[model samples]
Target: MGEQVSKQATIVGMLWTGGTPKAKEVEENMASYFNVLQGFLLYFYGSTVGAGPTLSSNLHQSVMQVVNSSFNLMKDSVSSYGSRSKDQKVAVPVLVGKVWEACSGLKKAPATNIAAIGRAMTQVAVSMKDVLREMRELKPDSGGQEDDQQTSGGVAGDGDGNEDDDDDVGDMGNDLSPEEMKVAELAMEVVSDLLLVIKELIRSITGLLKMEKADTSGSFVDSLEKLLKSSQVIGAQIDELGACLYPPQEVSTMEAALKKISSSLNGIESEVEDLKGSTDTFVKACSGLRGSIKQLELVLSCCSVGQLEEQLTNTSLSH
Candidate 1:
């Protein structure tokens, strides 16, 4: 991995300048170094595959430490790049890729799959939060940019404009600036994707439960449905808000989507509650049946003793 990374670095170096590296070459070198360091850190941190308080606490703390350091480095670099022309946005892609590459190092991590997923989710969340923070510092309360009103092909609200699109429904610490709102919208999109991932996780876990004969006979199935519905509700809201905030028309579509998701979530919540009630009733019925069986055994014992006594008395009389 180190050799491959070094080769990529050499290629990048070659592309940056014709041949002779100068003072400006230091910037590229610095970026590459940071990128490699971040990936290495995540790789090492995520590799530990034990449990208990030893080296296998949740990856949150260790990964977070990497994130904090990475963010600081990126902040300085982005600040330095801010003065460049819009055409110079080529640097943005490299930075974005580096950040994600670092994050991807935490991928396929050991320990537990659930924990791995959680770590991935946390990484995305922290990245979004940092972006929002940067936006706040830049624009203060700049309402937010409008949403995309049309796609390149002319579909309404298809995302042509420079509007920020997000699908996140959870609290973004309030006081959202336009840029922050945009970040929030992107976060929502990330969440929408994450929901699909989570659904897959649930399916895997459910199968595990069945294999272990672990009674998922609880409200688990219904609860899962409810969660999926809620996620849909949130995604729909972000789309609706984005359409409103952006350009192009067709509010009806967004509105209908929101309504459908909301209704589904409400329905699922009700079903989950009913499932709980049913399980409770089934447990009570089993208990009652058990008690009746014990009582019937007692009655049968007494009847047998009475018949035996009568037989003994008759035998004595005959003798």
Candidate 2:
């Protein structure tokens, strides 16, 4: 599949270099491009026949992403093939570049349904970590020390000369007033707690992956797929929770995100239990995460109440 896509890439790339491909040439190559994708689909489906239950979830999503994105770019490349030289030069090559990317991506797609879902959950963990990193950088209203930050560059590089993730996380204490510091501190704790939740979620995914399922029935795979879907929902709500953490924190929105995350976690626990998978460690992780989430919700509720009281007090003074 990869080799076929590469050849098509070279062949289609030539169309724009010399001149506009003839209409017949465009039509023929368009068909060829499609054939390559079709061949891949056949291979993917054939290889994962045992994983049909997950076909509607991560496995299916991964295959379609490669196929559909490649298809769209290939179609655009063909359209550019029949256009003016200037148009062809500007658009076709970029489309061809993307097609090459899709080709390369084909080799990297997960070979197993478990791996596909694992990748999805790992991606969620990575995103949540990014949010935590960013939130940790949240400064006091008086602000962070810009001069210190300027000088702190290159200070944390490792032996590989690769800068650590903490390179971006500036000094935690500079000129923070009490109230602002409290907010920043609590906000950081909330993000940190969320990160732990995703960590536990990934661990649970790992446990499932390590299990040997004697039951390869459709229902068994379906249950696993449901777990993947729940992980995805938790991932999304984590994103929402992160986004709502900015100034004047949207307590309701954050609460809503937390609620969804808690619900999804419950769903995951239920699905795993149905699979008769070992759930003791996972259950404990979920319990700990739920505790953290409750604390965050309580903090948000306090902030909400404080904001309301301040507004009310100001209104009374004005009256």
Candidate 2 per-residue lDDT over residues 1-319, each given as its tens digit: 6667767777877876777667888888888877887897787767666663543355566566667667666767766754655864677677667767766766676665566666766776787778778766666544346545544544653243335436635443333444434544665565565556556555655566534345465565567678778877876876786666565556788778878888887887787777566356656666777777777777667657456557667888999
Q: Which segments of candidate 1 are over 4 A away from where they belong?
A: 1-222, 271-319
Best by lDDT: 2
Clashing residue pairs in candidate 1 are 143-178, 144-178, 147-246, 149-157, 165-185, 166-185, 166-186, 167-185, 167-188, 168-188
Cα RMSD (Å) per model?
Answer: 26.1, 10.4
Query: On residues 1-319, what C-alpha lDDT tens digit does candidate 1 reach at each position?
Result: 3334444444443443343335465466667767776676666555653332312544555455446545544464444443445433345346445545545554433344334333443443344344334433332232333213224433654544424324222222334433334433443443343344334433343333342223334344334334444544544544453443222222344345444544544453354345342244333433443343333233333433345447667888999
Off by over 4 Å in 2: 4-41, 48-101, 143-184, 209-215, 276-284, 301-319
Clash counts for all predictions: 10, 0
